[model samples]
Target: MMTMPSAPQLAVQASVKRADEILVVDDTPASLQLLADLLTEAGYVVRVAPEGAMALHSALARPPELILLDVRMPGMDGYELCRRLKAAPQTCNVPVIFLSALRETTDKLRGFTLGAVDYIGKPYQAEEVLARVRTHIDLHRLKTRLAEEVEQRTEELRLSSEELEEKRAQLQALMGFMHQVREDERTSIARELHDELGQSLTALRIELSWLRKHCAPLGEVVLERADAGYALVEQTVQSLRRISEGLRPGMLDVLGLCAALEHLVSQFAERTGVSCSFSADADDYRLPENGAITVFRLVQEALTNVARHAEASQVSVRLAQEKNSLHLCVSDNGRGFASAQPRQGFGLLGMRERVLLLGGEITIDGKNGTHIDVRLPLVKGE
Candidate 1:
């Protein structure tokens, strides 16, 4: 026997079959009614919004998968609506289709930038509307499914990556121990070469001199050549000094981090006429070795980018410590860009990765000027 279906059961089945909710936003009642009838007939649950304000409210209330937006509404037109919608976290993922009378490329680009899925002009054909709506619904479904899969895969990958990193860190610590031992061995060898072998060579030279005095009438040319040979030995000793310095900078050992940074800035400013200026209130005694180098490299990259892209005559770099966070800011008076635009290049991307590695954040923007801000936290063990 066939039992009649319950109202809730039927509703659930209806919802399962129809996964798309389309919002038709138009000011004209006639246009709204026409689009509503067409979409309703095409197996879609349609809601009509007479104005942009009503549309935004209704969209938040219902959260449509696809929005058919009109360009020329009374208050808060479609372009600005799209912009605000894209900015909001809840509505950013919702695909928008601009149905407008405006036919300019600039208008289309503006709509696209504001996260519009498609732009349909006025006097849209019935088949065209049906086809476009169907295409967008399918596209929206695909995107939603893809996002879910990506998120799931990302979570799994994150767990796997964390395990892998733990293993890598263990190996790195072992390798670090080995490296320290190797460095100690090298230091001992260097001392031996300079102390024992060097002393032996000096003694041999003195004995040669004594032999030269005993064996009289040694040619002047031979003595001059012997002096040149001694000069060569002195140059070899100088080369050894340079090699020792390369293993570890003596400036870092003797002058401290601030002096090293000042020397770096001096060299950077001398090469580029960007008039780089720095300000610090403290001795930067809080930052560890890695933290100090990170700050220095951050400024270095910012200035390098300025020299290449900023084309400005002057630049300013500042570093200050406040509480647990250290702030670094670099600004240049070049042609600024619209901060609202999506990122296009990778210079900032690399910098962001570097900051994130140290559990910090970096911001690169072109408002009044190209501004870069990096904030690094001084953790207990950091």
Candidate 2:
């Protein structure tokens, strides 16, 4: 399965990884081979599928870093095929581009809404297509590598737990260590985004701003188009800001966990109209920065799920005290998950790691209403 992480929950790690392969699915063998050769020349490992059925089968065998699909195919057309590819958890993040003859606006929108990054029409320029494909494929690969490394370390720690005298204690310590590591990673990424991507995007926006002014003497239409480009650069800057914030909420570090939760809940309520309620008996108790931020992000992701996928009416976040530990409960009045579904998601798994770092136990109840309960050790004598 493709190890794709959520965009809102984009992982923070040492260095962003890059995609290694691209899957081109076209019924026409000639076209598929052409695209494959182009990508290979551009330093990408290319995989080809002659038909939609073969594409689906190949995707299942080993998901690609990105997919270039044809919209018009005899059977299992690109749109339908892309939908199925996206529906699979293993291939959801694999960027899909409808490299087809259809050029209508609606068709483009449908492709994008299905998570395709850039739609390329048939008889395309090879360079432009290669550029975008390279960009997305690299991004996907980076995230995949980071996740794989984290999972590997996690499994190694798990193996060591078998040798410990007290497995629970050992596991708790391991969880704490992992959460701290993850938090550190997020903090590092936030710094990098703000310092590198954020600064570069802003600088690009400024350059575009200069271009608009310099081109003003040329013609009104020229100036107008320059202005339009400037706006897009600014939009990209804002997108990076949001991405940085989601990685590590500036407020969680600038503000406390309680304040962060209050902000998050209010934001959720405003956006989702879900009436999110947050309470804290944590006035005097303070979690270590790592613990506090982890819990805050945990609640943030849970509420986001409620907003995006829960179809919940109301949600509650409670932070109470247990003996020597803090008890956090996030409950929602919503359609809960089916028991048979896989118990895996980067967000939930991250939360568990955070709680584990604090020597805590996490209980998730995906029954009638979704409930995530976490118990983490508190500051002594709290």
Candidate 3:
């Protein structure tokens, strides 16, 4: 039967398999061999060089994970080699530790300033050298791993943000398309009602009048009934006209945005018994069909909200054109509510969606009654 390896034995095997590569530089052969042997015993692959020149050449050829350098040598000393290594792009990141006879505070500071990670005395203990080497190697590996992780996470976040922006753009386009379809449907319905229903009611009224006038010696009760029928037909015609206008106002297409808004305000005041005023900077300003409808609908929705929610007597609407943008304001003297809280109704949400589709902005303030301000660019992509 075969026996499985113990935990300690498994650990040793794992460490050997993942052994770190180290470069040892010294002026004396004995010192280089001793350091190499010590590192080799610790499961690290060790490369030895007798002087600074050889060490530099070896490192340039194939850079090691960590470097153990000596201070005093014939041609190029450890300090010079360390400075050169740090300057080189390929070997700049490799950690270097000084193993030298010079143990003075100034010598250590000089080594550190030259970018040496650590300094050790000439009569170095085997255990201390091994411990310091192990510590620096582990630290360098951890730092490298951490840097890679940070870069990867940053890339992921950038991609995610880009994806989110793309999705939002797609959704905005869909909303605009749906809004256009709804407007077209409304226009079609309004045309049908005006042409078909309005004509039928008019014909009915004429027939009733003819019956009342031409009937020979008609009874008073019968004549009275004909008159009542005529009145009902007239009322039905008026109701149908009003409903058709509400679906899509003809003034919006005929007179332009300002005139349509004025008609809307006057009608609201008459119906709701709320005093409403409208003012505009320009009377003859014309907008495209879509723009005219958008402005008209905005005013209509605002006034509707005021009538339903505002318990006040007075309201004001204003419009102005400045440079390449149009500004609109609607305010009322009514009971106020907090604007920062999430809106409970879809009225505000619908308004926001409309403004967004036009690349415009809308703000609502309820601090002093209710005030709504809107700004829209006259030209698309401007």
Candidate 4:
């Protein structure tokens, strides 16, 4: 049994086989033999066809690097054959040089218009023929090599683009999982504070109240001390509630996103003394739990930034649903910073990261005052 050649062996064989093939088409036997001999002596593989039909068949079956065609053949002439060769995808790139007795400019122009590369007068000199043949063959080979390089580069770019897109998707998924874990931790902490610390404080306040009311026999100073203790315990309980709410707002879970946002805006105005207004198209937007929390946190961060950075008198936040998307805009009439300078704080960066994880778009414009606009799709891809 004959063993098949290895891949490396085949590659080596291809590399060593560098001879170019030339096809000569002429009705005259002498002319065909003469050109064939000339090309064969120059270390090229030459194929001779007595007529245009045979030449076309040979070229199509196994394409050659170049063709030396006689213009005045019997049936299918040189111009017609050139047109057919150019029309065929297989032989279209093969260089064709026409041989003719006619030396008129019109004759050469006709040959060129049909896709012939060069014209050789009938009674051509051997030296001129050899020079032109070598030049055209080299040019054709260079063109083919460049085309292959372009195709290879195009394939590399396509693969690179696909890899980049895959990496981006993986990063987004990781960030989203991290956000969910963070939210779960916050909820657990909030629940612990509300149930344990809150109840204990309330019970202590009740005990102090009982002592102040029932123990009248105690001195005035002792009774006053009980009252102060009861008041302090009450204040501590209220502060605990505020802290728990900040961690995970009860309103967001119970009353939905719109109500939670409204309550938040009311508290911000009361605490900051800045005129803050909130408006929505509908009472309840009916969003998924994660989506609702994402929107609420985004707005919360925006308000915090305004209070800290924006020295604005008035702020407006609007929420609306347009078809399949949710739109939110937060604008303030504040002393905006220079647009060219980057934001020094992590607030904006965190907001951008959160939006990208959810496959949303966010734009912050600090032209007149700070303006943050966000658009999110109702349905997100995993």
What TM-score number comes out for model 1? 0.41
Error (Å) of candidate 2 at residue 124 is 99
Candidate 2 lDDT over residue span 207-287, tens digit each: 888888799789999999998888888888877877787778887767667887888888778867788899987664656
lDDT of 2: 0.79
Write candidate 1's Cα lDDT for 186-209 as tens digits. 567666666786676677667656
> 3 or 4: which has the higher lDDT?
4
**What residue pairs are clashing in model 2?**
2-90, 17-142, 18-141, 18-142, 19-138, 19-141, 175-356, 175-357, 176-356, 176-357
In model 3, the runs with Cα more than 4 Å from the true position are: 1-19, 25-31, 48-63, 69-125, 209-224, 284-289, 310-312, 380-382
TM-score (all chains, Cα) for each model: 0.41, 0.48, 0.78, 0.81
Number of colliding residue pairs in model 4:
0
CA displacement after TM-score superposition, residue 228 of candidate 4 (Å)? 6.8
Q: How far out, in Å, is residue 165 in model 2?
A: 4.8
How does residue 77 of candidate 2 score in lDDT?
90
How far off is residue 114 in model 2, in Å?
A: 82
Instruction: State the lDDT at 193 in candidate 3.
Output: 94
Locate the minimum summed-lDDT window of 10 residues in model 1: 1-10
lDDT of each: 0.73, 0.79, 0.85, 0.86
- Candidate with the greatest TM-score versus the true structure: 4
Clashes of 2: 10
- Give a tens-digit lDDT track for model 3, residues 184-257: 98889999999888888888988998998975377888888988898899889888888888898988778877
